[model samples]
Target chain A: MTNSEIMTIHQALFIVMALAVLGSAIFVVTTSNLFRAALMLILTFFGIAGLFVLLDIGLFAVAQVLIYIGAISILIIFAVMLTRGMQGMVPRNSQAVAAAVTAGIIFAVLLLLFGPFRVTVDVARWPVFSLFAGNASPRDVGGIAWTPPNQPIPAMPETYIADFGRSLVDGNQYLLPFLLIAFLVDVVLAGAIFIARQRRPAEIIEDRRRQAEEAAEEAEAMRQAGMTPDVAPLPEGAVASTAEH
Target chain B: MDLINDLLKIIGDFIAGIINSIFGFSPFLADLVTMGLAAVMLCTFAALSFMGLTYVERKVVARIQDRVGPNQAGPFGLLQPIADGIKMFTKEDTTPATADRWVYNLAPLVIAVFALTTYAVLPFAPGVVGTNLNVGVFYIIAMGSGSIVAIIMAGWGSNNKYALLGAFRTVAQLVGYEVPMLLNVLPVVMITGSLSLVDIINQQTTLNGNPGIPFIVFFPFSALVFLISGIAETGRSPFDLLEAESEIVAGFHVEYSGMKFALFFLGEYVNALAVAFVFSTLFLGGYAGPVLPPYIWLMLKAAVVFFIFMWLRGTLPRVRVDQMHNLNWKFFVPVSIVHLVVVMALMKLFVTSPALAQANGGVLVTPGAQAAILFVASLLILIGSLAVVARRARILRLQEAAVLEQRRAENIAAVSA
Candidate 1:
């Protein structure tokens, strides 16, 4: 195939993938069945992962599959199953109009900001983009041969993963953000555990409080009786409260 | 044997050469063809492995229980899996009356596809990887995780209460185990300073006169943690609460039948195989062995690990749901965290101290030194943690005894009255 032909193929594939993503995303929100909606969301995630692969960001693609499709989607499905009345007709609300208006405004703003740019201009500026167009040598665009500005570029490592690791940990790059993310993740984990733990029910708390009050009253009555307190019989409530304590 | 070590690479190159010759003028077509071929090959390998594993597991488990297994089929049950496949293909498929039709139909396919896709990053031999992904290990974990969604789908779409309960357990158990599993993996990545499985294997090779040392020797505790968590991740026996037969009736797949059920079975075995492959790749020195083909060595290691899994299934009883959670949260998670800290600290010490580095020939500490340090540290931590747990158990027992005694005394007083 010629350069233009290859570009056409790629463009076609990209369009199909984009359609799949958008279609699934729309289905996710529109689907009445909660379970089906979760499944649609998973399809959306898979489409996004495919896009990541096309972008040559393989790590993010896999992470997307692992986290979004694997963990989060499962949790969503689990929640859907656990909740009763999921299959019931959803109540119609006026908030849908408001949500649609807000979404439309956001979409319009984004389009005005970025949609008008020409692909030709991007290709001209980054010329590396033309490699995807199949008009340029991939070595210059995809290979680890690009030089950094202001410094003699060193030989590239065997894989970019090492560079990615360094960029995260190196003091001059993303080190602070990386540390912040680690801390934030720990906080989130602790918060999740705190939130998910089984809490004492209000009824149980009320019952315990009533039992304690009854026990205190019984103890006071026994003292008031004052007829050899050591030998005096304790009430059932007092015995239960004492056992609990 | 040496030729066998390069066999996959040789075959790959030969095929590439042919494709290049045919589509010499079009790199795009050439690349496309190559990728398609690789995908087909990977899928075939996964499918074949799944079939072989089923037979192997049945025969092995049967032997463990001192019974003849599948001998009526061709050649010691070699043909049994084929028969089972035929039966599954011809069986009447059913969808539950109340099932969400689309999700119910798609769940098994999703699982099988995801399970096969995980092989894309696994390196079978030197220069014989599907893709030399930079984030290879992470990608594997990620792909493995995708199956959890499928499990949930299977459970929910079945519209069965038992299936839903199984799905809940799947999420709770599998997701819970991932933390410690990833934690255990971190130390290996720390030592190698790379996430690529190939790089990790290369670091352990006996190339350039350096000793080839498996990480298992240096970080046995971490390896144990990884293995245990891995078994749980695969939802295999003893940790197979997701499909506990007596309690939940095959768990999420109870409502499935025919080829859909077969797909789930295939996915499960493939996942088990994937876990074994990863365990061998990360900690068993991958394809590195003396005087044997690299791929063969890798297969041997994986087989041994799979056998161990089967052995464990036969030997250990399934733990209760509460006990499984306690094992993950109270024991594995804390120990994994502590192990990560110790590894990081030792790594820092090795990097900063020139004397220590020099003593180990300018790499991280020699494998022997590393083994000694990690072993001693893990031993101390294990003993200390065990002591604490023992003390807590004793205290709880004593408290129960006291409560019983008080209740008995109260009962005697009431009787006297």
Candidate 2:
């Protein structure tokens, strides 16, 4: 009968979903195995979808599942497999400085653009505050009211997709951006096709001969060690464990 | 007599009331309890259907091959699934020594659970669906794609090259086929103006004393694409098993046996069954019939679709791997896009014209009008595609013939020398 009980349940669901999202995201980065990392990334997407459902935005929730989980995660796994043996380049990167700088830039941009920046400590808030204020004084931050708004949420239209789609193609609305994105996608696709176009027979033969020469050089290197192994290099424990399963 | 038609809803409501009264729970909690009960019921229904489908698939394939199947298991081979179940339960589940243990254990469960979960949004009787989510069809697509990850996990966990290879090929096939399959759903959504299964179904329902026609009649090209892509998605018939036993030895689940193997098998049949159910809902006018109950109508239509899958499996030789991708990407995808564009364009044109919109008395152009325009467009597209394919095939054959002729002449000249 009490509204408090319903609110508590809603809060509980949010907590559970948030934890799942955070835990899986952390696991995605921390896991050494590429496949497991990819799987965890899917879990993160699923949790984010649950959060979307909690927000009562069923379209976003379904779109999250349809695009992020169904498509993007699979693409990630595909890319991971293409990496040397799906063996995630061992966790410790040699280019730590470059990686850190890139990650830091992405983090800063995201902080300036999105997130619960409200949750940030005051010391970590000024750069975001200034950037959001268009380089005005930090104290003059236009969008930074750290407190959540007390206003009631606006009601979403029932046919949100219909209205949104109409606006997307409307000339005064998102038409230019929409068409630009489409053009960009087309250009990117054409570029990829051009770069990966099939070679002539002579070029293919030359490429294969080069590959053979490289392989012969590798074989020579192995033989020069004077204790050449009979078999190819495989992941540790692979061959020995094959019989059990 | 009244209660008979609405019996299932009555039983479900009764259970919800009992949960509410006994637990003194809030209305939302009581509703949750009812949903939990419905989920369990749906699982039971799916498991039973899964068992029956195995027998049906075997018998259907056997009949096509001119052989009797599973007669040794029980009278008329009706009890064959039970015997097979017993065998599966009794077999040993061996884990690979160096396998990723948690992932190996999780993949089968993940796949099986995902398959079972898709049944939740499918409308059974009028009010007998589990949840009726607004995004029911997309939810199903999302769930179906989840199996791709599980397949990858199974392959990776097995630590076998063949299993890995199988996983790669299956993922490629499923993902490629999914594009056209998911594309086919768009025109239905566009036509119905809703993504929910109920809305889609009601769109095909008789309106204003006018007869209703299934979307398949309107967009047979899309239906053909959906059917082919859906069958490929299920890994059945001519598109069965990228991990052919002769090639990769049972694929992603090659390392699985006993109950683990059973779970994979369950996922397979359940996936096929789910696709059949969705096909009926989308194209066969799900649960819409006069005489029998709506649920019965749905089940019958789904069974017919399921039979068609088995018939294809039994009759058609498995497609060459290259041929399968070529059919999906090069043909089905492009055709589905054309079909979708035609339907959307026709609907927009018809709906906006004041003359066509008013002719239906109450709404935009009637389903009949829409069907006529779309069907003709579909036929034209189908004919044009076939002509292109025929010409391409002819050119390929001529090239082969010319090459063969030159080879034969060279052989004769060498013999004379």
Candidate 3:
């Protein structure tokens, strides 16, 4: 394929993928039903993963699917199922205008930031992007064609995993930040668990008393209607003790 | 034997050749055709494996319980799966009146797709992998995790209370078990110094023509933990609480029928097969054997593992939900963390210290010393943990007895009054 043809094909693919992502994202926010919105959000995640694959970052693409679509989306749907009153359209208020203005300002800031860096961001540096341009020979793209003055560049390390691992743990690189982030995540997880633990003893007693009274009332109503109540009645003493507590 | 090892590659090349010949003018089209053919081949393999596995499971479980299983079809019921398939195809496809129709239909396909995709990175034999992914092990776990989403979808889309509860149990069980499963796998990755399953298998090969040392010998606790968590991940046997018939009436796919139900069934068996394949690859010296083809060896090991799964299913009763959660979060997770620490420490020591190597006449220079040290340390750790567990159990039992006594005293006082 010629360079221009390759570029056109890639551009077409990018446009389609970007459209899918943006469309689904908009749908996710606009959808009334929380369940459908969560599903739309999953589609947005998938489109983003596809874009990552297009960028030749297969690791991140897989991670995106694994972490976002697999874990987070499932959790979101589960929460939606657990909570009642989420099936209807979410009520909108004046805050929507404030949110839109904030989002627009952020978008403008991003554009302004990128405009200065556009000249320095050489697209050829990304071999996969260059492959779409039809200008990256296989050897050049994979570092197989390059050699240093003093040392031979080792046969392009088998897969990028090793390089990624080294970069993560190397002393001069991301090791400290990686460890810090890991610690932070652990702390956050522990805190969440502690906060969401079982209810206190007093709260449990209060809950039991309320449920017992409701059950008694339901049984009384059923008797007035000449029907037998199916619910197992709590012992009178037990209900009294719970209420006292 | 060598020919058998190369069989998949040969078939792949043959298909690619045919595609190239037809689309010679367009390389892109040729590549696309080749990929499509490979995908079809993998899907067919998954389907066939599912059929064969169902037959195997029934027969094996029946024999374990001393009953004749499905003997009315072709010789010894070899055609039973086929008959069942026809029945499934002919059955009415129904959706609940309140179901979210699109999501309901999408769930089964999602399950099947995720189940089949894990095979893409599995190394069946030498040079027979679909793709030698750098993050092959991680990719498998990631893809396998996708099924939880599908289960949740099935549960929610059905708009049934039981289905929703099943979906909740699925997220709790699968996600909880995944932690220890990944933790156990980390030691194997550290030992091999790579995340690729192909590299892991290669590292297990014999160095001087002796039989290869499987990872199970050195890390038996991890192996046990992996198998247990893997069974939970697949929702099999004692851990199959998600679909407990007595409690939830078939769980997430309760609303499905016909081929939609068939897809869920197929996905389950495929998942079992995938887990068995991974277990064999990780700890049982994948595709390594004497006087047999690599692929055959791989299949034989996987079959043995599958038989163990069946045996467990037939023998053990399903655990209660509280028991399952406690086993995973309280028992397996802590054990796995301690095991990871021991492995990392021993590995670092083995790599840095030269005294051990010199003592063993350079034999220790290889991973042998590291493995030996880890094996001994793991044994000690296992014993210690077992003691702790016993002590904890004792304390819980005493507490239970005390509570019972108090209740009895109160009952007596009330009757006397």
DockQ for every model, please: 0.40, 0.33, 0.31
**TM-score, A chain, model 3:** 0.58
Clashes in model 2: which pairs? none
Question: What tens digits encode model 3's per-residue C-alpha lDDT throughout B1-417?
Answer: 545667877877787898899999987778778878777888898899899989989998899899999898999999999999999999999999878888899999999999999999889888878888777888888888989988988988887878878888999999999899899999888878788889889878863344568998778889989998999999999888889899999899899999999999988889988999999999998998778878889999999999999999989999999889999889999988998998787766665236745663333445566677888887788788889999999999999999999999999999999
Candidate 2 regions off by >4 Å?
Answer: A86-131, A134-139, A142-155, A200-245, B352-366, B405-417
Ranking 1 against 2 by TM-score, winner:
2
In order of appearance, the predictions have TM-scores of 0.81, 0.86, 0.82
RMSD of 1: 9.6
Clashing residue pairs in candidate 1, if any? none
Model 1 TM-score is: 0.81
Q: Interface RMSD values for the candidates, listed in order?
A: 2.9, 2.9, 2.9
Instruction: State the lDDT of candidate 1 residue by residue for B9-96, as single tens digits.
Output: 9999999999989999888889899989988998899899889988888888888999887888898879999999999999999998
TM-score of chain B of 2: 0.93
- Report the C-alpha lDDT of model 1 over A55-155, residue by residue, as the tens digit: 66777788888788877888777666556443433223235456568778978645533454323335566664554545554222323223436653354
Q: Which lDDT value does model 1 have at B120?
A: 89
Look at candidate 2 and tell me the lDDT of residue A185. Answer: 93
Off by over 4 Å in 3: A1-16, A85-103, A115-160, A199-245, B206-211, B352-364, B398-417
